[model samples]
Target: MRSSNLLKRAHSHNKQTLSSLLHSRGTSPHPQPDTISGHKLIEEETNPNYKPEHWYPARIGEVLNHRYELLVKLGYGMTATVWLAKNIHADGQSGNRKYVTIKINVNTLGEDFQKGRRAIAEKLFSANPQHPGYAHVRFMLDTFRATTKYGDHLCIVYDVLREPIDLCMKKFPGSRFSCGKLRVLLPALLKGLDYMHSECHVVHTDLKPDNIMMGLGDPNLLDHFVQHEHDHPSPRKAPDSHGRIIYTSCSDFGESPTEAVIASAKITDIGLAAWGDEKNTKPIQSNVFMAPEVILQAGWSYPADIWNLGVMLWDLVENIGLFDSISTEPDHYRPEQHLGLMIALLGPPPKEFLARCAKAKWYFDADGQFKYPKYVAEDCKFEHSIHRMNAEEKDLFIDMAKKMLTWVPEERWTAKQLLEHPFLTKERECYWDTPSLSRASTASVGSLIPSRQGTPGLGPTSVPNGSIHHSSLPVRLLELVPSLASSDATEPRLQRQSTNGSLKASENDEKSTSSSTLPLKPKMETLAESKGESNDETLHKKRSVSVNKSNESSQAMIDAILNRGKNHAPKAPAK
Candidate 1:
């Protein structure tokens, strides 16, 4: 007992010492006034490595231009660390203090590549000012370059998002998305893709569940939190190197903080986005999600993205990959197996598709039969495949998938064309017919919300007041093939020129690749948590932690989040 008490006292003393060191660095726990504008003070000049700092502007507690304060690390990937930051310019606008996602580009691209990235990203932004406001696309608010010790860092600011679609699937009772929710989400994805392809002239080569994000938090409260920042003045807080909090944003909500809702879905991570006209020589897209023509070294374009979206849709609703993503034989190439699975499920490719494929001989004979016919029929089918959806729904889904997954790239429907397909538009009014449907769907998952404890053990449930029937999520091909699941699926897309620099591989064939790899579930943090209110170990260790500080609205948000999960729980599998 005496030793335990001594240990507690020692921990307390050490924490206090750390606090004192932090306080000594500034007058108040907040950022020093001069640095608030994101400017380097004269004292910083004494550090001979000031220029080097510019190479890496993403340090914890680092203030930029004295305006944006890096608070919590929302996430990090190969090339960037996404920080949740507060704009501290004291612009006297309430919105200045609201949360923003700042993506700081690592010095991973060569000078030429970096220039190309910057130009393309800017073109995308300038092409359509209203594109960010689209329901499906992640909105970019600002962009700038900062010099650091490592090199010049390219930074882009965007609105904060909740979690990706994969988590939404896992959070549900049986790890599946409800049909109605899928109905709402898939179309939103199509609309965003259409807008990007037609309007922005961009092709998001990497389209997968990891890239689709669901919005959380009350839009009204978040809006109010930012818009009224001058009036409310959220106290500023910063986390230490160990992710310990030394300050806090003192923003206050009167009595009722509005509850958070699942907003409309959006497409994110346009890092590998290329213009439709540009013919990229390098191989692109993740392997499992790659289009057939891409593997054959045949030219690819927008239709490839459509194929990716179709596969992504299957993964989203069914909780399983449409393709095997694994190899069956040592000598037989994996891409051939990928095509074989397609044939086993959708039938043989057309002569036109076979003609276009330069390497068709590798997988198919002159007569269009798979070189190894047995691999096609027997190996692809799994025990937990999608066998439960009613015949009508299954037919509709297959119809759409077949249309998009055409062997001939040109035969696939354009984004705009897919939007018009009966599958996407039949059940509900189209995005063009009723603009308000987009807004309505954001807050529409009311009764469908689940409790906070965890997903319910119950089986499939209806999508609250909707016609579509939810089903038990099928196990993915990768899950069935343990070896394939463990393989680095995205690596082939890029041939690492240097461990630090980014390079696209012409030979590797992942359908989508990015500078960053996503976590199974992204950690969602609130404004309070961002301000160093919690410690690092606690935040990182907890898979899903809600903001539990004495804020009722935060508590309400947690309840709603959990409740949302319970509402989507699936039924038990049949005997």
Candidate 2:
């Protein structure tokens, strides 16, 4: 009878509207003894690390703090168990009651450690709400202590979110995100980083796929999950010798609508984050994604996060780690082996860079050469590793990665500068038609003069002019004139000449390309005429050329723009 009733409930659940499913006004049904079974195995129960004394035995329908009622276990990690819970005390219609995620940490962590972690999150998330990147970071809503027979557990509350990015990647073929998906996800993540670094002054030392989470793109996912769980209670194991029952976690949120796309992402887990002013020698970041400075104990800061993100991004796109040589064995990772892999891909670290590193002597000799030269894999080059991209796309992606993966911390591009990278902004250029360009030229030219103040997190506002940086203008100009790009088809697209060097665009052969002799007026008139612009509008638009430069002159300007970074390369800061 119970089995038949559960089947009927599930069938009825499938036909209910999302609103009716989630906002149903009634007390949730209690888990019945007939529904509990000891046959199904729970993964956490089988783990050797499972300790009954350390974990809080939270049961379904149990209310914590007299407010939140536990609905179902979402996941469990080494240190915590997460659950979906309802705010019974929230003032709303029964069907419209608020729901939240409760992360209950292991009692072994102690109250102080959990409180400290909560403090850091509260300080950073509330630092600057007006910043654009604020929305991309997961904010902590509340925290409290729950006392039980086992020990005191610290419970942290947050708004409900979808699963982590690592799990999301498994849904895609080859376990990789397409460049199109990256275009959407990466910017959202970068915005979060910009907020953490620029506005909050917090550095997220750990930034692997697990730390980044996908947002709830579909509103019905949570509703469906709740209804499904209510209909069919999760199977549970019988009591152990210590009388602890382990329940199977229900993590599936159901298949998304075919048209739904993951349009938002948020950076979570700031427990490892450090303030910019608190630069220390303590090691940070995951093993494979560790920045050179961090591995060497060379006093890292914001740039470490950039390097971390760059490697993680590569892992997302290529479905493998860039530094794959690092051992995964617990407590057996060798820094020298990781450094060798870095050398194989990024060439040798600059002697000046190695000089400041406290641990560099262990890896490099007095001459600044790798002590274990044979460990360097000669075949592991950056360009050869990238697959499935055309020459232009590959070049742009490499350019963006190189800016972040530099050995010198000062050389790495800041989060704001990377936002304007050609790889990221390529889609925006498609909207620039003839009339759009004619109107936007003045404003775009004005953007060339980097703003020193006004908006935050837009560009370099504090750095001096001679600092090592990539200019977005040259790429913007090339994007504006597609004819000029086509005119010099033979010219090499933007490519990295060396691992340690600045990126350079091609200087077309002087005599062969029409760009050398092309006049601005004829091109503008042709563009206007092609767009069916009246002669009078074309004349009026011609006067809008704020900078009195011909196409030939603009070509010269682009060359200057490409070479400017080399001339302004910044010196390493004093240790």
Predicted model with the maximum TM-score: 2
Where in model 1 is the C-alpha error above 4 Å? 1-57, 90-97, 128-135, 220-263, 324-333, 379-384, 428-575
- Tell me how many residue pairs clash in candidate 1: 54
Which window of 10 residues has the lowest lDDT sum in candidate 2? 1-10
Best by lDDT: 2
lDDT of 2: 0.62
Q: Estimate each model's TM-score.
A: 0.56, 0.70
- After TM-score superposition, the amount by which residue 326's alpha carbon in candidate 1 deviates from its true location, in angstroms, is 1.5
- The positional error of residue 269 in candidate 1, measured at the CA in angstroms, is 1.2
TM-score of 1: 0.56
Q: Write the per-residue lDDT of candidate 1 for residues 241-288, one digit (tens) a residue.
A: 333222222212222111112236778887777766555434667777
Q: What C-alpha lDDT values do all the predictions have?
A: 0.49, 0.62
